[model samples]
Target: MADDIREMSFEQAIAELEQVVGQLDSGDVPLERSIDLYDRGAKLKAHCEVKLREAEEKVEQITLDAKGQPTGTRPAEGM
Candidate 1:
């Protein structure tokens, strides 16, 4: 399970986070288990946030034409 969590992609992380929330909401887990799940969920949330920010930065770096569309030029090539 630990290995799977470590290997989770951004979408998988978000899905697990959502499942954690559902578990917490159901009030089925013991207090200690709830806390542990919350901690893991927080970490997953942070990882997802970082991934989203990186994707946003990449989008911003893309040059758009006057019509607000990508010009298809690779921006990093010039760097």
Candidate 2:
């Protein structure tokens, strides 16, 4: 299950997290099931955060030259 979450792309993780939230919001789930869903939701949230951070780092690597033109990408910070 841990590996599954780690392999998920940002879109997949966010979709699942939204589903979990909807389920929990409905108040139809049993206590034990709700606890399980919450745990998975937390993991999904963390994975999404990590993916966003990686994307931000990559976007920050764009190197520019004179005339405000993009030259190329440099190595991302904190790689």
Which pairs clash inside model 2?
Answer: none
lDDT of 2 by residue, 1-79 (tens): 4899999999999999999999999999999999999999999999999999988776657788888789988777775
The C-alpha stretches of model 2 lying farther than 4 A from their native spots are: 61-79
The true-versus-predicted C-alpha distance at residue 15 of model 1, in Å, is: 0.6
lDDT of 1: 0.81
**Whole-model Cα lDDT of every candidate shown, in order:** 0.81, 0.92
Prediction 1 TM-score vs. true: 0.69
Q: Write the per-residue lDDT of candidate 1 for residues 53-78, one digit (tens) a residue.
A: 76765653567899999876543542
- State the RMSD for candidate 1: 5.1
Give the top-scoring candidate (lDDT).
2
The true-versus-predicted C-alpha distance at residue 75 of model 2, in Å, is 8.3
RMSD of each: 5.1, 2.9
